[model samples]
Target chain A: MSNFDVIAMALKNLFKRKLRTFLTILGVIIGTASIVVMISLGLALNKNFDSQISQISDITLIHVVGVDQISSQSQGSKNKIKMDDSAVYNFKQIENVESVSPIINLSYAIKAISGKYSATLNLVGIDAQFLETLGYELESGRFLNDDDKLNIVCGGQVPYSFAKNTKRRFYFYDPNQQEKAPDIDVMKDRITISVDMDYGNIDTTGEKSTTSTAKAHPVKFVGVLKYDDFSYSPSDYNCYMTIEQVKKLKAEKQKFDKSSANNNSGFYSDNNSDGYNEIDIKCKDINSVKDIAEKVKDMGYNAYYAGEYLESMRSTAANMQALLGAIGAVSLFVAAIGIANTMVMSVYERTREIGIMKVIGASIYDIKKLFLVESSTIGFLGGIIGALFSLLISYLLNTTNISFFNNDSYIYMSSAAQKPLVSLVPLWLCIAAVVFSGLVGLLSGYFPARRATKLSALTAIKSE
Target chain B: MKNIIELSAIKKIYKMGSEKIVALNNINLNFEQNKIYCILGTSGSGKSTLLNLIAGLEKPSAGQILFKNMHIENFNEEQLAEFRKKYIGFVFQSYNLFPTMTALENVSLPLVFSRVPKKIRIKRAREMLKNVGLENRINHKPSQMSGGQQQRVSIARAFVNNPQVIFADEPTGNLDTKTTFEMMDLITGIARKNNQTLIIVTHDLEISDYADTIIHIRDGVVDEIKNKE
Candidate 1:
């Protein structure tokens, strides 16, 4: 028989039994919704995680550290050791090595004196080139220029604390955004101090030593940094300075030590000509930072990053998303069961109708198609409803201030000022949810259609 | 006149718990075109069984049943459906009208299955409904109509296909005497007007008057044939 005839009859039959038909369709709707929602949730989680990971550090970054000479000696000479400046230079030559910077720890307190305000703040010195080696967005003023002499910049908290004691305001436009005014200014206004020695004991004896106040230079308040809640604190913080200033301080301390006949505070080298205690080497690009770090480690010094401090902070969100997706998929499986049940009932209720169609010259193919169409339609409707529901949920979650980010467990390096948290659904993900739900309907409907076609006409017609 | 339905030594056997009971015993029968015939029997006498066998709804246990020289007994289920659609019309005792459909739609079903155009199918179905005097009740579903009206709609469905043979299995069985005669007259009148072979299986002796020939069956065997001059 013609396809229209069977479809018309089946539809009419279904309409006659409205409750049964609706119930069957409901099963498919639930199934489709479950599948779509499950997958959508999973995808949303994955997306959140990926963005979080990218925020902390690009996945392609490779960390390189200097092979510890002290450890190598203790472990015996079996391990080859060739880590040196040449290795750092070689890493820079690598194809994908975008940028590299060497990190060193030196804690020193700074004593600043303006007309009325004066305070001591501990600071780690990072070179101007080191800023370029990492993904750092300047808030207000420009980044440290190559020609900057004795220039200084500080993290988000530093300016907040420093400006409290000083008359000059720190202003820097947040580089993470656009159209906002400059808020941080670290140029010619904030003063930073350096000690003659790196955490060395100050001599109590001798000519009016460190106990006596020394002259403090006025540093510019060029810019302010946007808060990264995942990283560094403002109270005791790192500061950017020219390598020449650190060398000058070391030389002055050595001269004072020699004159006093005391060897206690004269710990480090005297000049930039004698090589720096820390060197912040930068590569041409950020992509090669990890490779260059590896090379730097091979040279015998520790390579560090501001990015590594925020690693867990970024990755935790991604992990949460993955977990969410996995949880959502379980609901879809239940939906599939609903669809199956509906289809089975439909087959049962329409046995006589199917038999009649067969008697009226309906082909087996036609019978199979009719059932499949009905099932597919049910699934498709379910998917649409599910998608709408999911969209609403997503919208609510986004609009609500439900904080899924920023916690005490997040490892905040000395760099972060505020926690990072946001959720966004991509277009492709929405489309995929729709298409996947449709596919679920088709697959779930297939078995019932086959079963309906295989039913014997004699028996089906005889069914009461 | 050519015989439209022919049965040669057709046997129908029923197996009841390993015991084979012969329902129709080597019955050989021929039905001529343009005539009304009734198979008269009590329940389980195999008269309805013979009708089913002739309609290709059931296959014989032995021997061949032929329709216009084609061996219908040898036809498979699907082939039999095609054969029925093309040449045979059925009128069941309970007037098996699709309950959801109106009288016109019910009558149009066979033609619809025939792949006839919608306009043509509807027109022919309306005409057939008119012939059965159900033109006014064309839009009424089976459940909304009386037994006589439903039976008339059934007769229209059978005739709408313009089949060569019409098989009625106790068309008046479920109707009252008044409606029974009305149904029989409408069915026989339509079949005769179309010059089609009408086969009726019934227990009512009064209904036999509408037939030109009657085969009285007893105990799954044909006892006698009566011609009403």
Candidate 2:
């Protein structure tokens, strides 16, 4: 018979027993929905984890620390590696390296005085041009520019350090009173940075001594940083200045220290003769971070990047998805068994009908095709309904904040500023669900269809 | 007249546990084209078994059964299905109409198996039903019609494919006397009009009167052969 005729007949037979067909198809629908929802939830978790990690630090940025002592394989001897301007230039030449900045840490004892309020703060020097590429988002004013060498930007919480006078101490561990913005505006007020030669000194009696002499340097506040919940780096509590400006301040401090009776050696002297203590390198893409980091380590420097953590996070997400998929697969396997059972029952009930068909010149292939078409139609119909149901569940999960589990148990809990979209169903997944269910139906009907074809016309016709 | 089917030394055996029962024993017969023939026999006389062997529904154990000189016993199941589709039609005592299908659909089944297009097959089925006086009942299902009408629909189905031969096994066995005579007249008239070979198996002697040739079977073998013309 024509394929169209066979399909029509199969449909007619299925419709003959509507309730049974519907029940079988319902099993498939539940199977498909379970799988799709499970996979979609896994994808949503992965996306949330990625966004949280991205907010903390740039995955492509690698921190390079100079090795104090390294074993030189070529010379068969030990040597020291310095992270200097030359190292920055070498890193810039590395493939996929976008930008490199040498970090010069200044240990000058300095305090910022605005009107009567003053505070002691840490300081770090960085390249003014590469500040934007380093992913530092400014809060108020523009970032450091090459032309503004003397300008400085205060951290978001730096303003909270100023009190009524210089003797007023600030404690970071105090949690009773939240720090408020100081009355003195660093952006508008005339701020002077004073360096103390005898800062942190003690007498023979072990009593704290005030600075005997100090020099003040006038400076401009160009910008302030935005507060980051996850950032505990110096940028959160210290100040940033151009490398040239810090170099000049260091030279002045050295001159003043040499003229004093108390000739205390500087802490920055070890790498001061050649280069800075560290360098930060930015890669063009996250995928290239590992390769560039390895190259920097091969040059006898210590490299640390977030790529390793991100890699582990990705693998964990994939494993969770696979586990969820297996759970879904078990449901679909049960649905397939339902289909096979239904088809076998149909064949048993239609034995006489099948015999009549055989007597009327219907081929064994036609008999098999008819049963296969019936079962597959059930599968395809179930898949469509199941996909639609999954989409509805996904939409509800994304829009609603109904939390069934402990909030802290979720990986995306840190990024709780917005409600998490916990389920995501992509287009490819919908299509695959439909096609896979259909294949399951075909496989389930195989044995039943074969049995229908092998039925004896003589015995079957005689059967009631 | 040319022989449409020939059975030479054909045997059919059935095994019930360790006991052996011979259904047909060394039977030799020839059915001519464009002629009405009947195998008259009582129950368990092998008349139906002989008809089944001739239709390629069963295989012979010791001899050859040929349709137009082709050994039908050697044909595989698939080949037999093809043979039945192209050259044979069957009418059963139970009518065997698919209750879910309409009268027109029931009649058009053989044409469907032959791969005839829908429009043409429906048109031919309508014409054949009209010839059997079932034109008005084309849309009625088998359950909706009487036994006589159901048998008429079955007859229309048998002749709708325009096969070379038609087999009827107790076609009127479930009908009353008047309906039986009506069914016999309709079947024989159609077979004559189409010039097709007709083979009917019945236990009733009155039903054998309509056939041009009669082969009386007894004890798994042919007892006698009689011709009217």
DockQ of each: 0.45, 0.64
- Could you give the C-alpha RMSD of every candidate to the true structure, in order shown? 6.4, 5.6
Number of the top-ranking candidate, with DockQ as the measure = 2
Q: Write the per-residue lDDT of candidate 2 for residues A1-464, one digit (tens) a residue.
A: 98999999989999999999999999999999999999998887777667656765788899887652443344345444567777888899999999898876665346566766676655677888777787777888988888776688877777777655534334253333244556677787887775553343445666644554656777788898886653333465667888888777766666666666755533334345357757999999988999999898888777887767667877887898899999999999999999999999999999999988888899999899999999999899889899999999999977887643224634333534466658889999999999999999988999999999898886788788
lDDT for each residue of candidate 1 in A1-464, tens digit (9 for 90 to 100): 46676567656655666785676556545554444444454454445444455555545445454456675576567754443345446656666655544333233334443323333343334455656455566655755665666565555555434322332322232435333422333454445443422221223442323443334455664544455644433322456555455445545544555664434332233233233344444545555566666655655556565344444534654575566665555655566566667778878977987777665555566677777666555556666666666566656655665545434433233124332333444566556666666676677778988898788765676687
lDDT value for model 1: 0.65
Worst 10 residues of 1 chain A by lDDT: A194-203
Model 2 DockQ class:
medium
What proportion of true contacts does candidate 1 retain?
Answer: 0.32
